[model samples]
Target chain A: MEVKKSFEEINEKIKNGTAVVVTAEEIIDIVKEKGLDEATSHVDVVTTATFSPMCSSGAFLNFGHADPPIRMTKVLLNNVPAHAGLAAVDAYIGATETSFDRDIEYGGAHVICDLIAGKKIHLQATSPGTDCYPRKKIDTYITKDSINEAYLFNPRNCYQNYDAAINTSGRTLYTYMGVLQPNMANINYSTSGELSPLLNDPYLRTIGMGTKIFLAGAPGYVAWQGTQFITEVERGNNGVPTTSAATLAVIGDLKQMSCDYIQPAVFEKYGTSMFVGIGIPIPVLDKDMLMNLAVENKDIYTNIVDYSVGRRSKPSLGKVNYAQLRSGMVTLEGKQIPTTPLSSLSKARAIAQELKRWILTDKFTLQEPFKHFNKVSKLNTLEEVGKGEIDNE
Target chain B: MSKKAYKQRIYIEAEKCVECGACTAVCGAKALRLDKTTWKLIYNVQKCQGCMLCVSACPSRAIKSDIEDLPSAVAAAL
Candidate 1:
């Protein structure tokens, strides 16, 4: 018998979910080798990321009531599901929230999602400040000596200084609020020390209504465009240009989240009344491998499969465009590691099952199990977000 | 009881705006959008209930209102 797993088997695994973490660079490697489909044959991939200068773990640990982390993960995972055939995955947090607390540090990656989702209503200190309360001297950077001497010099005054610094940091400070492809591309270039398709072809306008972009981390640019068209830079899927199997894994994780959380709320908020923009990063797909897999699994519909493309990856066209093309958690392995690795497929299914249980559990007490919501006027026509229609015209 | 006067006025600075559309996104009165002729953001001030959501959501902080100018304008119009 062949050792390969079937779609149904893999689908079952995704229904139950967990943190299927990988890096974006790794997916590129997988595409170059396996062609994309074979590599992603099994997995539910999405981007769940945290920013640097901060550890994602510490942010989760400090989640005021521990609900922010759960709410954040739940929101990302709700975008992807196997049955609907939409690709979606949880982008992992790259760093902790503390790293973003520095003065002058406008904000970090995770904070961006919160900003878009309306979770984090206020912007905090990105850097620290100094003051001249007693002597009226200028206060600037935070130093090791200052850290050690804070208490010794004046404990109460130290609190005063820190509070003043924290408050002042938000004043007149500017940052990119949402996911901007160009900005994302720039950040990726600086971090990975590599050039990306998004930066080189900065003018490509790729977007589609079927895709809903998730910010794995905080505000990098202005704000979530909340509309489909981005002009100053490329549209969605602007940065990534590697055909890889790992992209499938990333899509799988993201799809699960799409179905579970984002679909309902985004549909409600952006629905029929107003236009909304989604900033998606593009991923490579091996057309041949994808065709073969579907052919091999003759029972699956091409339409469903095509729709599923929106899960972890984006189809290089449409108004819900791709931008700031940057990499996710997957590292640049020669044969890119599957974003939603076949091995980790079961983990995703488990998570999905747990989420279903939680949604039902909370429904009774909260009346609405979903957390991230916008109370827009009652003109909601979209039955679901990132699904509705593409209007291919 | 203390006597009080109610008024409303809206102002926008074009330079700072990025046109994120958050105002139109949440406007209960359907009074905001990018003006087609100039692409400058505009609003139907009359339809606005003064909820100030647009005022709050302006990412660029370019929107302002004149409480004093509104009542007189409304009274004069009436």
Candidate 2:
């Protein structure tokens, strides 16, 4: 039989304040020094993390019914439009939704951050009145405390891997990846390198649907596999994908979240977004998991893609590992270009440490996913149908 | 609020700043970026129009806004 540990066993140690927990970064040195066998046997949990701009993040809010309730047909939070297609007073504010009256500077991320900071938010809604619920329109203010429920329910986040970006065009390209300098003058990338949760468990062995995680400084749960949860992507020698891979949909209480972990960001001419800090503690279920946790920055690789093409299928420029990306420069076509890792590494390190402390102090417990994610293979595409004939010219 | 009416002043605490380029991404005035020589976050007070976007974009919370008392070097740059 193989050496293994159970969630019950880890929780028992956590309760007694005896579980040996380390971050994915710390596990590298521990394995390097003590050897994989000794390190795997000693470590009970390893936390992985990332604090990066997650564009597919949002919050669902349900304000309790008013005196004579109105079914909200349109909703706006602090001038930012929210999806009001849900129930009477419930709405989903996506992070990327820009303010109706302002530029990209103010948006759903600002509204979400204001709510998290306990600042008041301007709320406005319009509805076509009905007999039972006969209110026409509403204009009011709401804070996180004032709302009945405010939860961060992101559809896609924690991207397993993202290919670095470079521009081969004549002009600077303002993209979600960052400002790509013209003529391949700069290479832009975003990841916490080895500390990323999905990279640590590419196969989704220990991470599952019910897995408890630190989401935006709050204890949250993995809702499901995210929007583009592809598994059949190309991989490097280290078992990590070199392209965009698995993502996670996470849910947490917005009231319990802090502004520090959910900071807002604005990409010039692109849109508004937020830095979603997510940390997952991978319980050392077996030596295989521990070995996975011990993976380092050098082994993880990503490809540099040309963003100048402006298409779904951009051409791959070159294959580069995280080590080369982090070194601040990469050689593409016999020329060196400066690089920028757009994600906040300091915040990622802090989130990992915070998650480690949560487990060591017994505040968090490991959960084997209630159900393993559906092994989705092929992804479908939206077909464009023209009434007459498809024009290719 | 007139842009010229208010005298805006700001400073980024050097030791606490992480030079993550988050500020550079949001800065509309082109006042913030990591110095190519030292790779340290540099704020060109001369060029800063003081929209204060960097204050929120900074992950370390090192950027300060609306300071009445200004250092001589910062004032000179301004």
Reproduced native contacts, each prediction: 0.00, 0.16
Any residue pairs clashing in model 2, and if so which? none
Q: Write the per-residue lDDT of candidate 1 for residues A1-393, one digit (tens) a residue.
A: 212433234334434443122223334455456655555543223121111111111011111212111212221111111011111111232111122233112222223223224342231111121231122112222221221110000000000000000001212211212111111111111111111112221222222222222312111111211222222321223222222100100011211122112111011111111111111232212233222222111111111011112243323211110111111112221222111000111222223233333323321111111122121222223445464564545
- Against the native complex, each candidate's DockQ, computed on alpha carbons, is 0.01, 0.19
Off by more than 4 A, model 2: A386-393, B1-10, B13-19, B22-78
lDDT of every model, 2 decimals: 0.24, 0.83
TM-score of chain A of each: 0.23, 0.97
Distance from true location, Cα of A291 in model 1, Å: 26
Instruction: Judging by DockQ against the true structure, name the best candidate.
Output: 2
After superposition, the stretches of candidate 1 with alpha carbons farther than 4 Å from their true spots are A1-393, B1-7, B36-38, B66-78
**lDDT for model 2:** 0.83
**B51 Cα displacement, candidate 1 (Å):** 1.2
* Docking quality (DockQ) of candidate 2: 0.19
